[model samples]
Structures are given as structure tokens and as C-alpha cells.
Target: MTATPLIDPFQRTIDYLRVSVTDRCDFRCVYCMSENMTFLPKKELLTLEELDRMCSTFVGLGVKKLRITGGEPLVRRDIMTFFQRMSRHLDSGALRELTLTTNGSQLEKYADDLYAAGVRRINVSLDTLDDQKFADITRWGRLPQVMRGIDAAQKAGLRIKINAVALKGFNEDELFTMVDWCAERDMDLTFIEVMPMGDIGNENRLGQYWALSDLRDSLRERFTLTDLAERTGGPARYVRLEETGQKLGFITPLTHNFCESCNRVRLTCTGELYMCLGQEDMADLRKPLRDYPEDDRALENAIRAAIALKPKGHDFDYSRQKLDGQMPRHMSHTGG
Candidate 1:
């Protein structure tokens, strides 16, 4: 009932799909967002059925992993109904694993139903441990709500990934504290080096982010840190506390760009296919899905054309430069 999965001229089998359901988000993270973002009109975004058709095509091609994201995926109106449709379309076995990344503002209420509908795991974006510092960074801080979402996810039988963006002067001191908080709950914590995304000329931008090596050294002074080989297409490299069973992951995108094994591709909320995070070029998917609904070949061909154009990687050096100058869309918008 499915066609072969799409593959590019390079012969890499395209399988993973990260879809942005909506550009609307509840929070404003400094580094990855731009306030001036004039959102796409509602009629332009892919409807549920249209999105399902694309997802089915990808699954037929060879996609085994599917992740739902957004500026905050939960911010999409009627999100629960969307999940139900996606769940019925793919089922648990059709897609190897289905997951989502949320800002945690609404997870407390919907976490259980989200899991019931087919999401196996949920990752929450949480920057700081201090309430005031959290507010200062997110502009509204809502740390309590974020924490409650974490608890809700744990209770819903979903594996938790607490994503922490390490800021140097803000709350970098609490990196291990954040780790311990998750360790106590048996959840994993990943510390990301705030990536330089979006327009750098924007005003409310980030200052400096902590480096991975430096964080390892600091954590070693207190807890015995050990390396683990587990990793994925994601930017984070894993480390664990020797005695506490606490794990830490470092995403050093700014210093060491991991582009060689870049096996994934992204789909924006409006249906454009972006090959890399740093590049501006993208292929239009919405046009074909609507215009050539009967032509599967055309849709697959367009995707291949985009894949052939995937750039090598990004150019970033935190020591001498900052990636904060010109931001791409917000991280939420890009499904980060």
C-alpha cells in the first residue's frame, strides 16, 4: 500500500521526519526566537489530512522515526484531535517511535492523553532552576508551570528529556543542580550550547553560552563524570555521574559542528523542506501537495531535489564570533 521511501542522488536513505505543526508558542526564548515573526496565515499551513498524506509517503519511503515539534507543538489549536488522527493513521508499529518536544506550559493537563494517543516520549524545554532567573530569560519565567509539566510527563508513562540551555552568567551554576533534579526522577538532562539561530540584529538576544569542555571540568570538581557512547542525530554528547546514576548531555554546536552524519531533514510549519539548520534555502512542499495531489511522483521528486542540495554544515566559532547576529526563524518555528 506504500511506495518506496525517497532517497537522494547521494544515496542516503531519508527516513527521519521532524514536522513543525504550528509557529505559535507560549514562551519567548531569547537565543532562538524573533518577535517580529509575522506568522503565516492559517490557510497556508498544512491541514491534518494533508500532513498525514506526506507522513504516509515518508513512512513508505523508509522513515522509522517521527518527531512532532513546533514553536511549541502544543500551542496549535485543537492539538489533541490532531494527535488522535496522526495516531490512527500511523499506529504505534507503523512508525518505529513517535515523540514530541514541548515548552511544558500545557503538559500537565495533556501529557496523559498525548501519550494515550501515540506519543511515546516527551522532551520539555527548561532553561534554569531558579524561578526569577527563568523568568528573566524567558521574559515571563513560568518555571513552576514547566516543572509541573515535567511531573505530568513522568506520571503519563512517557520518558522525559529536560532540555537545558546553558547560559554563562545567568544560571550556569545550576547545571548540575538541574541534572540532580532529573536524576532524582530518573529522567535525562541535556545541556545545549545556545545555538546561534534567527536574526542577530534583534534586540532581546542572548549574551554568551557555556562551552561543553568547560562544563565537564566544572562538574568533575564535584561529581565524578564518566563518558557514555550513546548518541544520535541530535547534537548532544552524553556523560554520566559515576555514583548517582545521573546522566548529562552536552550539545556543543557552536564549537564543534556535527554535520558529517547529518542524516535528518526538517519540515517547517508552513510545509517548506529545509535541509540544514544554518542555511536559508528551502524547497516548497505545500505547493505540490495541494497542486499535484494525484501525482506522488512529483511530490517525491521535489523532496529528492531538495535533498541533493543539502549543504555540508555550518560555520561557527564561539571564541571569536557569535551566532546571535542574524537569527533564522525561532527554534520553535524550525522544530528545534
Candidate 2:
């Protein structure tokens, strides 16, 4: 039997859940994490079986869309096993969609398996197409390897979307180039504003910030953008390019917030439920999951309790050249 749908205090039905399978990644993007960082110990992470149970519980509570994220989800050991396990929910019609966000580093090895497991679309974090700039942006990423992975994923018939972080003075020159490239390859693109998170100093955060409004104005010089009244269950707002007929998305957390229509929550690999991305409030679900291993009643109650405390909106601000409402946790910690 399906449990009652999870709803927040503002009467928003929580139907989407983003699960972090691991806290480790192969690349350390400049805006995402520090060059030299320490990752979580494997012992602290929830086992694959435990993750399956937790996600299944969410499905039972009417979570229609599930997105598996990570520092890089594909890099986790035996990660496809988790995708394969979750496919059961998709097959049973309890879950509407099952997808993931990756860095495109491991897609070459797992692309076929991901398609087999019911992932029709995926988001790949690619900041720059220039090899040298790509290397600089992702401290440890090789542009050629990522390109090969993208090729493999395309060959495996997975719909790809490129997610780029808009950094001032970094990829401003390649804005048009990126749009043309995605149009040629039949892939959608989204530009995200860098959020104030992790070990970033105020000076660095201020330096890297790029407003999407400025970006939109730049594109208007060369293209016609038509606003689309559709959302993909995430924070991105879409606009269709009249010339290319391809969709472009913008995630502007600083200039404009999308928390009013928020219907999602993030779950860390350690069973921590983060109600909002820009806020520090979270609930530890690990204890309840382990304590009531045989019965899911306590676990469900805990999830309900957490949802009841969900805030109406986040307070991420970058006004007057000051960084405010910055979270201490790294983006990778909660699976950006």
C-alpha cells in the first residue's frame, strides 16, 4: 500500500528526492571544492543495501522522481548495482523516473549499464570545452577522457544535458561557442550561478559569482529566447532558443530564488536529510534506519518529522558585494 504523500509545512508535496550515493569524486572543480580536500570515510557511508531501503521507503511515500547524485556518482564502487536495484521501482510503476547527475568521467565504462537500468536522461557537469580551461576548472579532469565518455553515453542512447557553472572572466568568451556546440550535438545546456558554499573565502566567492541576468542579456544580442512554462522538477527555469529550437536553462540562486515552488529534498550518503540546499538545517536518518531495521514505521515517522520542519525558502544572497547565507558544508557533501 502507498503511504501518504510527504508534504511540507507550506503544503508543498515532496515528490522528488536527490540521493547522494557517495562523497568522493575524481575531479575537484574550482567552484565546487578545494584543490586539496579530505573525503568522508567509507565506514560512515550507508551501504548499497541501506540506500536501497531508504530510497524504497521514499518511493512508498510518493517520491515520483529520484535523482542519484554524488561528488561523482559513477566513480563509486559497484555503483551500477544501486541503479539496477532502483530500477525495480521504475518497473513497478511506483517511481516516475530514475536518473543521475555525473561529471562524465566514468560514463564510458557505465553508459551501457545505465541505459539498461532505465536511465533515459542524465546531466553531465562540463564547465568548459577548451581543453586547457577544462583542466584548470576541474583540477584533476582530462578533457579528452570526458569527451570520450560523452561520446560513449551518446552511443548508448542516453539523452545528455551539459551543466556549466558561469564564472566571471572564466568562460565568458565561450558562451556562444557552448550554445552552438550543444545545438550541433542535440544536447540541452544550463548555466548555473556559483553558490557560496564549502571552504571558499568571501573574496573568492565574490570573484567567481556571475549573474544569469547578465548572461541572458549577452545571449539576446545573438538569439531570441522564448520563456517556457515547464519545469523538470528541479530549480532550473527554461527558455527555448528560437534559432536552434533547443532549450536553455538558467539556475539563478543568487539573483532570483526558486524556493517557492520547491518540491525536493537532498539525502546525503550517510543518511542525512537536508531540507534545503542553502540552509544548514538537516535531520540524521541513519540511526532510525538502523534501529528499526525490521520495521519501517519508525523510519517513516522520522521522514515525516523532517518534512514537517522544511523552511519556506532559502536566503542565498550576493548583494552589495557581500556574501550572505553561505553554508559551511561543501557542495559535494550533500551531492550538488
Candidate 3:
């Protein structure tokens, strides 16, 4: 029997799913988290088997693209085993693409294994290029380690994309440098505007939110950017350098909104299905999955109900005065 396709109220065909394997991370980036964080207990996280079942349900509902994310996905134990299990779907015709987003702190050790498990595309979150500045932003991150990880991933025959969170007074001056760096390596670079999601203890620093429009204008001064008409099933809008074959992307949630075309949903490690990143609307999948472990129909019904309730757009107006506790979920918990 054919299952019904999952569609939001706005008629958006939801096909992309971002799954967070764990909320634990080693770095405490100023923009991502507070100095002190309380992570979820190991018992509270979804087991590998549960994740597989849920993903299978999503795939059955016409989800073709799956992205594995986390506070840092590599921090999870036996994650490669999970990857191998999911690779079976990709091996068959059930799945189209399987990608991952990581901080690149531990990619050096697991890059080969990830490739062997059928992961070809990767996105690494790197905020700065300077070692000292990297350490400053990430609290205790070593720039060399991340750089080594990037190199290893490239060597392992993976398509690498650098996800840089554009923060003023930090790496804003190095935007052109970053472009050049990626161009030299034939890698695609994406600059994301720092979002005010969650209590990262830096709400007062909202002035540092760099608009993507401004970044685009700045890049135009140096290089010719030709907009690409193709969509990668993600929020980022891609462009090509007229002089070189390098591609650049911008994720402007603050300056420019992309919610009208939002075709994805996020699932936290504990089975919470977030309909939108900037809103508090979610469906509790853990309870249903736990209670009806063998009932695929129940799981699909819960997910479809959540999709039906998905909001038209997020209510993140950055111009408004700072409210008390705007966002309830942090980036780590929500799988940013």
C-alpha cells in the first residue's frame, strides 16, 4: 500500500530531514552556547535502532535527503555503525542522498570510515581561520586539529563545504580571505548570519549580526558573483565566481528570510520533531516511538500530524527589542 506524502499547510513538499544524533559537543562557541551547558543524559538519547526506524518511516513518507547533525555528530559513540546501517537504504533505491554536518574536530580520525559507510558530502562548521581567533571563539578549540580534519575529509574523497558563522569584529574582515582559501582548494564556502536562537548568553551582542545582503555587496566589490538557478534542497542560495569556478553561498535568516521555501524539518536526538528552527512548535516523537516501537503506522501518523501543524514562517524579527527568553531551544539541542 502507498503511504500519503507529508506536506505542510503552506503546500511545501517536505523531503529533507536533519537528524541530530547527539546534543553533546566539545567546543563552547560564543555564538552557539553558553560557557556552561547541561547536556542530555546518555539514557535520554535515542538508540541507534530507534533512529533507524524513525528514519525509515521518514523515507517511506518521501523524504529523500537525510543530513546527520549534532552538537558535534562525531562525539557520539558508534556513530559509524549507524551510518553503515543507513547506507543500506542508500544502497537500495530507498534514499537519494546521505550527508553530515560536523564541527570537523574529529573528522581526521573518522573521515575514511565515513566514506566507506557511503557518505560523500560533508559540511564543516568553521568560524575563523586564525588559530588564536578560532580558540577565542570556540573557547578551547585548536585550529590545527580542524584543519587536519578538513584535509583528511578531502583526502578521503568527500565533497567538503565550509559553514562559517559570520560574526562582526571576528571573521568579518577575513571574508575575502575565506573565499580565496576555499577557491584554492576547490571547496564551496557558505557564510551564515549568526542567529539569535536560544540563550547563548550573548543576546546583548545582537549588534554583531552580519546581514547577508551586506556580505553579498562586499563580495561584489572584489569578485563577480553570478547567481545559480539550481537549488540543493537546502536553504542556502548558491552563486558562482565569474573569474574562477568557485561557488559561494549565503544563509541569511536575519537580513533575508527563506521560510517561504523552507522544505525541511529538524529532529533532535531525543525524538523531538521541530517544525521550524525559530519557533517553539514541535511534536513529541519519542513517546510515540517508544510506546509503539513496532507500529510503523503510529510513527508515520505522528510525523504527518507534526508536518500538518508546521507554521507558515518563523517569527524571528531581529529588529524588535530584546524580549525575555525569546527562544526556548538552544542550537545544540535543536541540531543547528
Candidate 4:
């Protein structure tokens, strides 16, 4: 049976769902969370079985692509079981893709298991390549560990994409170096503008904001970047490097909004459905799911209600030397 398609208020089909399985991570990235972080209580988080049911419900509602994320999704205990169960959606052709975004610290252990469970591609959040700089950025991440994980993933036949958060005065000097490095490894690279979210202990959001437009200009000096009209069901806009022939993507949520064509929604580890990443508006699906555990109708209706209130766009502007439209929750809380 064909499930009723999930269409938002703006007429965009909500087929992509990013689910945060846990709010805990081993590496506390400077941009994502504070060095000394307080994670969500385990009791408040949905159990792995609950997560499976919630995701399965979304799949029944026509969510074609599912991306498991977290502070580091691999850190979750027995997370492979969730992936193994979700693979049923793929086997039935109900889901097109099942992937995850990781910090790459745990891939060495989980990469083979991820492939066996149906994940063919993944996005690894790597801000810098320098070992010391990598440690400084991720706070607890070791570059060698991540590199080993990347090697394992590649060896396991999983496609890899490097996601780097473009920070001013930090990775600006490594622009060419990063691109060339990814190109050499045959991995696609994406540069994202720093979003204004949560408190980073002592770091200033405005100070770290790096406009992706400036970075694009810098890339133009070295490579012939021709804009490609292809979207991977997300906000990234792609460009092919004429020299290396590899694809480069730019996710400019601050400098350029990609909301008009937004076709996804984020589900937190606690089962809160966030209509927009930049907005605090969220619908508590947990209450509905837990209150009516055996009632699929109630869960479906609750999801539909949330989709109806999905905002047209996010208001994340970093202009005039100020950080406007900032959210109080950390990126790790909602899954970046």
C-alpha cells in the first residue's frame, strides 16, 4: 500500500527525516557544543526500540530518506540493531536511502556493520586536517582515529563525504588544501557556514561566522567551479571542480537561505519534531507515541499536524556584525 505523502505547508514533500538517536558524543566540537557539556538524561531519551518504532512510522508516512545523526550516533549502544531494522524499509523499496552524519571517531568499529546494515554513504564532520588543529576544533577528537575510520569506511565500500564548517580565521587558510585533499581521496566535500546556535562556552558566534560566499570566491581563484543543478534532498548546492572533476557543495544557511525548497524535518532524540532548525517551534510526538503506543492512527495524525505547521523558512542571518535568529539549543541537541 502506498502511504499518504507528507506535504508541508509550503507544498514541499517531506520525504527526508534526520533522526537524532542520542544527545551524547565523544568529541565535543567547538562549534557544535561546549567543552564541558551536559548531555540529556538517558531516561528522557527514547529507547532504541522506541526510536525504531518512531522511524518506522515516518517511513510508513512516505519518508524516503532517513539520516541517523547525533552528538555522534555511533556512540549509542546497540545502534546497529536500529540500522538493521531500518534496512527493512530499503529491502521493501519504501526508503531510497539510509545514511548518517558522524564525527568519524567510531567509524573504524562500526563502518563494516553500517555497510552490512544498508548504509552505502555517510557524511563525516571534519573541520580541519591538521592534527593539532583538529584536536583544537573537535576538543577531544584525534585526527589519526578519524583517518583510520575513514579508511575503514572506504575499505568497507561505503561512499564518504567530508562536511567542514567554514569558520573565519580558522580554516580559511586551508580552503585549497582541504579541497585538494578530498579530491585526492575521491571524496566529495561540502563547506557549511557557521550557524548561530547554542552557547560555545567562550567562543563568539559572530566571530566564528564565515560567509560561504567569500569562500566560493576563494575557490573560484583556484578551480573552475560551474554550478550544478542537482540536490541531494537537502539544502546543499553543488558545483563541479573542472580541474579535479570532483563535486563541491555549499550549504549557506546564513548567507543564502535554502528554505524555499526545503523538503525535510528534524526529529530529536526525545521524539520532538522540529519544523525548522532555526526556530524553537516543535511538536511533541513523544507524548502522542507514548500515550497511544499501539495506535498508529494517533501517531500518524500527530505527525500530520506537525507537518501542517512547518515554517516556510528559517531566519538565520549573520549580517551587520551581529548574530540574529540564534537558537538557545545546541546543534548537537537537534542533530546537525
Query: Which regions in candidate 1 have their CA more than 4 angstroms from the true location?
Result: 1-11, 35-37, 89-92, 200-206, 322-327
Candidate 2 structure quality by residue, lDDT tens digits, 1-336: 347899999999999999999988999887887887888888889999999999999999999999999989988899899999999999999999999999999999999999999999999999899999999889899999999999999999999999999999899999999999999999999999999988844338888888999999999999999999989999999999998898999999999999999999999999999999999999999999999899888889999999999999989999967778988889999998
lDDT of 3: 0.88
For model 1 the local lDDT of residue 238 reads 87
Task: Go through the candidates in order and give each one's C-alpha lDDT.
Answer: 0.76, 0.93, 0.88, 0.93
Ten contiguous residues with the weakest lDDT in model 1: 198-207
lDDT by residue (253-336, candidate 4, tens digit) is 987899999999999999999989999999999998899888778889999999999999999887867778989899998998
* Of candidates 3 and 2, the better by TM-score: 2
lDDT of 3 by residue, 222-320 (tens): 889999987888889899989887889888876677899999999999999999998888999999999987677788889999999999877665666
Q: Sum up the clashes in candidate 3.
A: 0
Off by over 4 Å in 4: none
CA lDDT of 88 in candidate 1? 61
Clashing residue pairs, candidate 3? none
Quote each prediction's TM-score.
0.91, 0.98, 0.97, 0.98
* Candidates sorted by lDDT, best first: 2, 4, 3, 1
* Alpha carbon deviation, residue 59, candidate 1 (Å): 1.5
